[model samples]
Structures are given as structure tokens and as C-alpha cells.
Target chain A: MRIFEYMGKELFSRFGLRVPKGRVVTTAYEAAWVATEIGSVAIKAQVLSGKRGKGGGIKFADTSAEAKKAARELLGMKIEGHTVEKLLIEEKLHIDREFYLSVTIDGGAKKPVIIASSQGGMDIEEVPENKIVKVHLDVELGIHPFIARNIVRRLGLDVGSRQGKELLNIILAAYKIFQEKDAILVEINPLVFCGEKIIAADAKVIIDSEALFRQKDIPYIEEQTEAEKLAQDLGISYVELEGDIAVMANGAGITMSTLDIIQRYGGAPADFMDVGGGTDMEATAKALEILLAKDPKVIFINIFGGITRCDDVAGAFAKVKKEHGIPVPVVIRLVGTNQEEGRRILREQGIEAYTNMDEAAAKAVELAALVPAGSL
Target chain B: MAIIVDQNTRVMVQGITGKQGSFHTRQMLAYGTKVVAGVAPGKGGSKFEDIPVYDTVRAVLQEHQVDASVIFIPAAFAKDAVLEALEAGIGTVVVITEHIPVQDEMEFIAYAQRKKAVLIGPNTFGIVSSGKCKIGIPPNQFFMPGPVGMVSRSGTLTYEIAGNLIAAGFGQSTAVGMGGDRIVGLTFIDVLKLFEADPETKAVVLIGEIGGNAEEEASVYIKEMTKPVVAYIAGKSAPPEKRMGHAGAIIRRGKGTYEGKVKALAEAGALVAEMPSEVPEMIRKLLA
Candidate 1:
């Protein structure tokens, strides 16, 4: 999950890392009050997205009136589809130099990697590979002092200088946060040197979603759509897409492949929903309801049940069809465990089910094409 | 003649008395797997399905000559469970548990490599040697004994493709689910090497999705293999930055794109299928 800048800074402060003093506020009045206390402030929109500055989600103010004006403009502003609900009013820094540092998981290497560069406050991807230094660390032997020192020196910092020592300590602290907090990414873009002090100008911390059960104290912002939240509650996975056919399947791979097949047959998928393994009648019915809410031209249900039973899924389609009556053209390809019984259940509801995935997908695409544009 | 599990492979069930454990245990047993023992802490000295249940793997090791152990422990305690199995000197460990912390997985995967052991998955459906042994929770009816070896990152998709292959008169020698997590124990290259050496496997099918560079990396290895490989990648139409069910199934920063993976596989001489249904026919043509 993506942590807000203020929250990430709070975590960094807990690890003895220096950060500009700031307070998150939801109202312009509070923003003005914070600016009054801090003298000059940088009003940053607290949304979980990058390039906020380029998107006009960030502004600077030297006076209380200017802070209030900036806050009024930023609050409720949309940047990259995220509404600005909170603003971090922080003391602006006078930086002598800017550098980049981060600790993130190297998925291909299967290890934690430290990425440091002399360039800062820009997309690290655009930076030339020669300017960036990456070091993969062993989980067993964490970030030793020498490794941190070497990283600092490689970025052109003298090991004996006080600035290098401070940067090294910050790097060590970032690694500590990455390990102790179970974070997938801990980035401090533009670790600025202001006269005699170094401070993290920006904090981007993303914790491992699977490790959230252990990191109970971390605050989570509700960013999921209504359908996504419902799916999460049902122990299923749902991702909304822009298409005419709604796709549902028993596994992530099969669901994605089902979408691929629909696209192959000149049809677009409206959403991706996986009912998950071992989904029973009620969850399947709920999944159907969620897909129907998307109001696609066609509802394609594909099940290659392994732990999930076809009969149970068919029972769900039957129950939903009887209760509310499915309004869309429903195409199902049910196979695997108890498939004959599943087909029987669907047949009783006057719903013909296909056994072959290709044929079923083609039929759904054909049905979807029959519906005129804006007919729904 | 399979690569990993065979008829002679002795298996043990971790968390044997739990809901998922006992249920799949019966399925494994029904499929003719040589399940030798079970481990459910505090349920030691008990018998589940007449298989002696011990509290720990070390205790179970005293009696049973186990070749592999399949775990069904929950995510919270999964680390210790995997460590226990590994420390007790089990050569092969298959973790069926999903939602295990990636840190714990990194630790165990590194440890497994250090010990020179084969660890299957932290979130996988498990491996199946057709007509011989079944380790995880795949439907037994879908598999048939034949010559095609399959490896996939997804579970039911493996079953779907396997069913299609069976319909085309192509049975699998062994179908392995390399797990769905970002950091899995085995990679496409690892399993591809195994299938390359196994004489029973005449052709290979690799099912990959949009995530990481696993398939692109595997494409490099596919060029070196003499065996025929048919590849089908999912998530061609999937949008970027959205986690499509699996944690690892997302495209970030324009990396791990479908086009990149498909082009790499096709350029490396693997027959890349446009759809899952096309995979069986591709395998047939290659084998023919």
C-alpha cells in the first residue's frame, strides 16, 4: 500500500532520519495556521501518485494568506485521478544540493536493492544508467556500515566529510525502515543538503500488502473502488476495465486469459473478476451481482474448476437468474468437477453452457456485437 | 519417469488436520500419491486417514522415509513452518500457502538455495506427475499420462490448458505450477532445464502472464533447449499499474509488457500462442 508523504515522513522520523517539520491538514484554515507557525511552507497535495508538481498539485507560499490561497486551490484538486483530500504544509528548505536514494525490492534478483544517484527530483528511469549505482543486499547480512559508506562514496561523496557521514546514516536508516516495516519500497527523492543539515524532501514508502497483517499500526487509506472493496471482502479479486464484455473466472490466470480470448475475438472486456478457488454458491452469486452492476453488453463466465466445483458455480447462476433475472446475454463455459450436474443446473434455467472455452468466448463476442451502440 | 514427483516419491502433509490440508490430503491419496505421514503440531500421536500424525517434521522424520512435504499452513505462521521443514533436512518442500510475507519467502528461498534443495512455491497449486503422484490441489480428472511437460505461473489456467491438451490427445508427463507470487522458489528456467533433461517430456508448454521478466529471461534459455516449447502469455489487454488478482501480475514503469514478452519468446524460436486454445494445436504441430 502507498503511504502518504506525511505518514512516511513520520516513519522516517521514528528511525531518527531528519525530515522537514510538517503537518497534514484538510482545510485551508489549518493550512494557513500551519504556515503561520512554520513561516514559509511548501503545500503538497497528499495523494498517492507521482508527478504531483507537474500536475499542479504542489505549490509554495511565503505568507499565511498565500498558503491559504494555495490550499484552497489544491484541496479537492484532481491529479492523475486522485482527489486531493489532504495537504502537507511543510517548512520549505533552501537546498545547497540534491541527491536521490532508495531501497526497493529487485524482483528479478530476488533481493533488496539499494539505488542511489547524484541526480534528484526527477524520474529515476530517465537518469542514465552510468549515473546511478545499484547494489543488491543479502537479507542475511543486511546493510553493513561499509556497504553504506561505499554507496555514499560512489555517489561522489568523500567518506571523511560530515555530509557523507550524514548521508550514510540516512541510507542506513532507510534500509532499516525497509526491513523492519516490511516495505517493498522506501525512497527519499532529493535528500537535500541545506547549509549544515540534510533532510528528506520527499518520502515514498510502499509496504508489502501481504505483510500488512503483521504491521498492524500502519495507517491504510481506502483507495479501492466499491466493486474492488466488495471483492476484497468476499476474498475475491476484481479489476475494472473499459470494455463491453464482463469476464468472470475461477482463477487469476484463467480470468486474464478469458479476457485475452475476448479481445482476440474482437471484443473488449469491461472488468476482470476472479471468484477464487473454492468459491461456493453465495460468493459466486455475489460475484455475478457485482459483474451485473458493471452493466456490460455480455456476461462471460468461464470456470475450469480445480478446487472450485462447477455445480456450485452453476447453482449460483441459477439462483441469481431465478431471483433477479439476468438481463444481459450470459455465456458460460463450465468444466471440471461436477460439470455434468453444473450443466444440468444451468440448462434448467434455460441457460445453455459450453464446454469448450474458444467456442464460448466466440459466442459471447458474437452476442456482444449484436447489441447496438448505446442500446443499454 | 517424471522430473519431480513420481510413484515412488513419499510425501508428508504439513498442517494435516486443518481444513484445506485434510481435504486435499484425501484428494492426493485418492489420486494414488504415496502419502507417508502428516504433521499437525499438538496433534501428534494421532492418526488422520490412518497416516500417523506427528507434531513436527523432525518427529515425523524418525519413522517415515519422506521424499517431499507439502505445506498447508496459514500465512502468519508459514515462515516457521517452512523453516521447520527445511531445518529438518527435507530435500523438497512445496508451500501451498498464499499471502506469505515476501520477506519470509526471500529468507526461505535463499536458505533453500543454500541447502541445495528444491522449493516449489509459497503460493502455488503444486506439482503433478501424471498417473503417478499429485502434491497440491489440482483436480485429478484433468490430468492424463503422456509426453508433454507443462509449467505455468497460474493454477486453473494450467488445468484449462491441460484439459485442452488432453482433448487434443496430448497428455502431460508432469505439469508444475511455479507459484503465483512475485518471488517464487523456482523459475521458468529452472523447470525448463528439468523438462529438457527428462526423456518422458517430448515437448514443453510455458504459461506466463504480464509481470517481471521471468518469461523474457526464460526465452533466453528456450533458445538453448533442443526440446520444442510452446508459450502462451496472459494479460495482453491488461492495463498497466493495476494488480490483476495476483500480486506479481502487474506492469510497472512500462516494464514487463505483453508485447516485450511475446516478441522475446517468438524471436527465441518458441511457438507463441495467441490464445490458450491455440496452445494444444501448436504443441501437436511441433511434436508431429
Candidate 2:
């Protein structure tokens, strides 16, 4: 969940980070008004992915007329699959110097790494390798004040200037904001300097998805439909497809392979629902219910246990059968630790478990063909 | 010495009251897995499949000497649940929750290593052995306790391959889904080592897909293994950008590309199959 510059600034401002005073507007008139107030402005389009400039999503405007024109052109433009419906008319700043500062997750390291550079404003990827500075920190160590000061010093910010401490303080504050928000990435691409004061000319923040439950205060995107929301609420993630078989399973890899197997077996998965690891009977039952709700032609529960037990899933099937009728035919293929016990439980409960995924999948397709098509 | 779990395993479920947890918990109990207890915070003192439900893993361990735990806690609390399970002296913790924050995973994985408790997955299907108790979610319909040992990065891929094995008249000894998350407790090589040593496991099935260097890394282990190993790698037709599949299966940064993994595995002297449908036949041919 990436936040645009307008939202990023709100967080940056709280940390005493400096930025060129500006306003965001959706209309041409408002854009012209901001242009008049700020004198000259940078007419930037708001889109999700990076490299907005290379995508021709950004333009500079000198006069109010030029700003309005640029904003109008950008407001309806599409950049990298995202529509630039909004424009950020920022006041043009007098940048004496610019530097980079960022906090991002290093995927391989599984930890947050703070990335900084003496060179900024231009593409960070193109920046000279020697100019960048990086620091990897443990989640427990956190971003302390000393670390911020050290980062500034390494960037040679002390160049005998009073702005050094101010820059350090702003960057430090931003780091705090980053941690508080559970941000996956908080970056100030160009921390601008004008005379003795430094300001955040640009800020980018990406919220970690798993932290969404904890981030009650942050606004969330409401793009998903009601059914999608319900599926997410159930803890298992699902994506609807055009296939006839509804696939439900335990892991991302499992979910994907379910879809692929369905395709290879001459069937398509109507949807993908991953109950995730360590699911219980109720969750598994609900996952099955959710698949049923999708009104799939056939339900295929493909599970390959590594830590999760098959007997537990069998119990979920029995429970679901007891609680609610399985509206559609189900083909369950589960194998992993405690598999025999899981099979016995399923057998005792009168729910059949398919030892072979291919056999079960074929059964699902055969069963799906038995049912007539109905709109969901 | 089947990988991950065998008959001696004492299993416990952490969110047993929930639909998914309860269902899988019963499966573990039914599989003769020595399931001692279940844990669901507010549902303490209750029972799931005749197993006592405790508030915490400590209580479960105190009541019954359990060594391994299977977690079905919600994504938000998955990391904490796994940590507590490890702290409770559960040597092996299976986390079946997905979408756990990367930060939570790093801390838990690092700590689990220090605590000497193996955490299988934040997103995994679970582990299983034929005729023994099972944990997590794996289909038991196809398994008949044969000589094949299986490990996979993708759950369905494992299922498809294992199905081929079953169809080919070979049953699985123990099948482990090593998880699809970027960081997991165990690796393909780790499970391969167990399979190589297991007397019952005459041949091994390794299911991999495009994404991550796991397959390439496991190739080295395949070379050292004494038994014949059959391999299958997917993602040959996956789009360059995330293939909209497994969270970790989406190849990026050119680290675990499909071509790279398949090439590496084939080079390491393991018999590699082309597709899921081709797996069982390839294994049978190699064994013969």
C-alpha cells in the first residue's frame, strides 16, 4: 500500500521535516489557484508505480496558466497502467543541495535497511554508486537518533553548516514515523537544502500489508467489492477467476499450483482461496463455505501438508458437513504429516479424502461437468 | 528417518477452535499423530477431538509432553504464536498462516534458530507420513505409506507429483511442503537429507517452481544423495512480472528464475521432469 506524495507529506510534516509549501488539487482551477499562491510550481501527476517522469507523468509549470494546462493534461493521463487523475502542485524550491534518505525492507535479509546518498533528485538507480550510503539494522535496534546523526555525517552533511543538525533531526523524525506506521518503505528521494534549512522535497511511504490490522488510523483502499471484502475478512485470501472449479488450499504455493493443476487437467479454477498455514477446522470449514459461496462448478481442496496435518483438515470437512450442507461436490486431496489420522477422521466422518491430487482434480472436473452452469 | 515428522511426533494445534484449526487438528489426531492438546486462547479448558484445549502452548506442554506444534492462529498473531510455541520447548513449530509481515517473519525465524526450534512455515500446508500421524493440511487419500519421500515449494505441485507417484504404484513415506514464503524454517536440502537417510524412502520427489534459489540450492544436496531423486520445476511459461501466483513463486530480481532452477537441478545429476503430468513416469523410469 503505497502512499502518494500528498499523504506522505502529512506524515513528514509531523516529524518537523521541511518541504516546499504546496497544495494538492483535483481540478484545473484549484491547480491555477495553488500556482498563483506558490508563484512557480511543479505540476506532478499522482500515480502508484515509480518512474513517473520517465512515464511522462510529470511536468514543470512556471506561470499559473502553464500550471493549469499541465495539471489538466496530467489529470486525465494514464501513466504505467494507473490514471493520473490527481495532481500535486508544489511550490518550486530553491535547492542549494539535495540528498537521499530512505527506510526499506531488504527482502533477502528480512530486515529493514536505511538507504541514503549524497546525490539526490535524479533517479536513485542512476546515481553514482559511490555517492550512496546504506545501513542495515535489526528490528530490535530500531532507528535511533545516533544512527540518524551518523547517516548525516556519512553523507558529509556537516560541511560546516547549521543545517546539518536540522537535516539529521528531520531524517530521524521520519524514521520514527516509518516505524510507527509499520512502513515497508519510507523514502525521501531528495531531501532538499535551501540556505541553512533542509526540507523533504519528496517522500514515499509503503505500508506493509500484514500490518493493516494494526494500522487502524490509516485510510485503506476500498477498491475491492463486497464479496472480496468478505473473503479477506475470513482470513483466507481469494481471487476470482473465470474457471469452473473453485480451488481452496493452505499456502500461496499450494493455491497457485491448484490453479495450474486445474488448467493442466482441462479445468479452470473459478477462484483461488488460500486458508494459509495452521488453519483449524472452523477456518477450513469457512474456507470451504467461501468456495461454495463462489458457486463453483466443483470444489477442489488441494492440500500438501508440511506442518499442517491432513486429519485436521478432514475434521474441518466433517464439521462443515455438520454445520452446513456442502452445496457443491468436493474433491479433497490432502497429504502430509499425520496424514493417516487425518484420512481416518475423514473416513470416520464419511468424508472421502483423495490421496492423489490428479485423481481428485479429475474427479472435480468430472463432477463440475455434472452440474449445469449457473450465474454467481 | 522421514523428513520433518514421523510416528513418534506429538502434535498440538494452536487455534483449534477456529474452523481451519479444528478441522486440521482432528486430522492430526486421526492420523495417529499423538496429538496431546490444542490451544485457543479464549476457548481454554474446552476440548477439540478429545484433546484438551489450553490457553497457551506452555499449558499444553505442561499437561502433555508434546515436542512439536502446528499453528493455525490468525495472520496478525501468527508470529507471536510461533514464538511462544518455540519458547515452550516445542522443538518443531509448523506455522500455517500466510501473509505474515516480513518483519515478523525475520525476527521469528532468527529467534527460532537461536531457540533451536525448527519453524516450518508462515505459509505452509504441513508435513505428513503414511500410516503415521500428520500435522497441518495434506490430502491423505493418495498416500499409502510407500517408498517415495516428497518435498515441495508449491503445495499443489507436491500434490500433483505425489499423485503421479501414487498412480505409478509408489506411495509416499513422508511429504513436506517447505513453504512458499521467502523465508521459511526448513529448506529443500534439509528435508532431502532426511529422505536420503530414511530406509523406507527408496526414491524422492522434489517439486519446485520458478522463483527463489531454493531449487538451485537443493540441487547440491541432490548430488550427494545416494538414492535416485525425481524433480519437477514449474514456471516455464510464467510472465516476467509476478505471475499472480504464490507470493514467493513470482520471480523477480532474476534470483530464482524458472530456467535457472531447472538448469541447475538437471546439471546436478537429478532426473528432472518437464511437467506435473510427467513426474510419476519419470520417477518410475529412473528407479527401474
| Highest DockQ against the true fold, candidate | 1
Q: What DockQ does every candidate get? A: 0.81, 0.24
Q: What is residue A276's positional error in candidate 1, in angstroms?
A: 1.3
Among all candidates shown, the one with the greatest TM-score: 1
Interface RMSD of each: 0.9, 4.2
**TM-score of structure candidate 2:** 0.76
The candidate maximizing lDDT is 1
**lDDT of candidates 1 onward, in order:** 0.92, 0.77
- lDDT per residue, candidate 2, B1-288, as tens digits? 566678888788888899878777766666677888889898889887677899988777777888788888888888889889888778989888877876688788878877888778768777888888678777556566888888887665676566667777988898887787766778787788888888888888888877767788888878888998888776554554343446566665356776788788888888877556677787778677
Query: Which runs of model 1 end up more than 4 angstroms from their true locations?
Result: none
* The 10-residue segment with the lowest total lDDT in model 2 chain A: A221-230
Per-prediction CA RMSD (Å): 1.3, 6.8
TM-score of chain B of 1: 0.99
Candidate 2's C-alpha runs over 4 A off are A95-100, A119-134, A145-175, A193-198, A222-376, B42-46, B189-204, B209-246, B249-272
